[model samples]
Target: MRYGTLDWVPALDRPDLLAAPVTEALASWAQAAPDAVRQVLVAEIDPDQADTADMTATYDLPLEASANCVLVAGKRTGEERIAAAVVRATTRADVNSAVKKLLDVRKASFLPMDRAVADSQMEYGGITPIGLPAGYRVLLDTRTSAGPAIIGSGIRGSKILLPGEVLAELPGAEIVAGLATEIAA
Candidate 1:
């Protein structure tokens, strides 16, 4: 398989390309949802271009086909809540409104980069929803639920491409209609 002109292989067959947790997650997902998991494909990339804008341009990919997995957190009654919000690159997560409300917190903000990386055990620019901590909610934007999408592979040297609908089936994922606001692209 291929996406953006890059060769892709079954993520389950190439554990070396995935972060450790991602490898485990994919294995479990594959067993439970083989049909969806079978469609997931991974491709190697230059770590330097792993960031979205750089990768999209360098690989000649459509922005609409790219997705970003943003980590956010807030506290409610002294209990901390974390969520991984996945939205299209053409839009931005509605962190201040939808997310704050969903979390039932007074405020929500991007999880600090250092902690996001350390806690998730994923590289800073490659934190993916596939392997997040069990406690973290996975909120997937409605607009990204039925098309092709390019997302992080839990490592800076590769990416995952799969149909958007599959994300909705990920463990603990919820499809939220107003989760993101469109941005000028």
Candidate 2:
């Protein structure tokens, strides 16, 4: 699966995608993370083609290597818990059963797109877990966290590639078994 030359530049140098906070967090995490997880890559992308299917076909990225991060919110006891779930593009997150239980909530639902964008301060199609607002739980499906993966760069015009372990090890990241289920063909 030759992903081709995405012009893998240091994440720190790509402020266009890796916002200041994200960059800062990555820098700090790298200091303590394993060598394989230290190097984060960012590549220029066309905003219109940033979606998983489009990016994979146009950029030569393997479908299996692409991971999607979805924001979910659950409420219980009059409190809201918002989390980001990272799953392979080939599957859908098991939000109702798995995530609801993990969140200790009666139900879980996708976060509203407008609120997600505004709260995360990231473009709708480019919300990565690396720079999410402080205290938001990050949940990585075991399949996604088991290897390297491609994800959004927090902006529409760029993409990021990093070891899945990095995502699984992000602050408050929880590797959930069966967090995602394979989508029917």
Candidate 3:
């Protein structure tokens, strides 16, 4: 199915009808990034989604990548604010060291599945940085903003393509550098 300039199976308008979980996610993303057109692609089970998939191998490709970050409003141990950082597949978000310091939180952790889904209003595998609450902080990796990149659309089965700048316009979105780095294989 094609919506706008991008082409993929299981259109975003009918995510409930799609059979693949990832496809549904991608469809939702397409709707979110209507301007990105033709940059997003829906593939089979991404290696990143597989527990056994090699991180090094997965990072080497040009796939739609989104990073999960925990944000806190204060410098307390129990305060946990979860946010998603979308970036290119080649890079990983600097959650523990950099993002943690930026949010001024005592600690930052990767959002667990249940909490991520609930907080972002996205399916387990389909959380994007867009369509989040206005107050929730969404930090975009520099690489993602440099060009057109694929990102999640609050679902798990699909991805959408759009210029990274558009993602910054989403509510509570901020652009930051050093959010991601390539892990040496």
Highest TM-score among the candidates is held by which one?
1
How do the candidates rank by TM-score, highest first?
Answer: 1, 2, 3
Clashes of 3: 14
TM-score of each: 0.98, 0.92, 0.63
Query: For residues 72-141, could you state the per-residue lDDT of candidate 2 as single tens digits?
Result: 9989999999999999999999999988888899999999999999988888898988878886888899
In candidate 2, which residue pairs get closer than 3 Å at backbone N, Cα or C atoms, i.e. clash? none
Writing each residue's lDDT as its tens digit, candidate 3 over 1-185 gives 44333354423444442334434434455566554423433433342452212321443434433333333233455765555665566567777776777777777777666766666666655555555655567787777775555555445444544556655555457778887777665
lDDT ranking, high to low: 1, 2, 3
Q: Which structure is stronger by lDDT: 1 or 2?
A: 1
Q: Count the backbone clashes (under 3 Å) in each candidate.
A: 0, 0, 14
Q: For model 2, what is the C-alpha lDDT against the true structure?
A: 0.83
Give stretches of model 3 more than 4 Å off: 1-61, 64-79
Whole-model lDDT for model 1 versus the true structure? 0.91
Worst 10 residues of 3 by lDDT: 50-59
Q: How close is candidate 2 to the true structure, as a TM-score?
A: 0.92
Which residue pairs of candidate 1 clash? Answer: none
Give the Å shift of residue 2 in candidate 1.
2.3
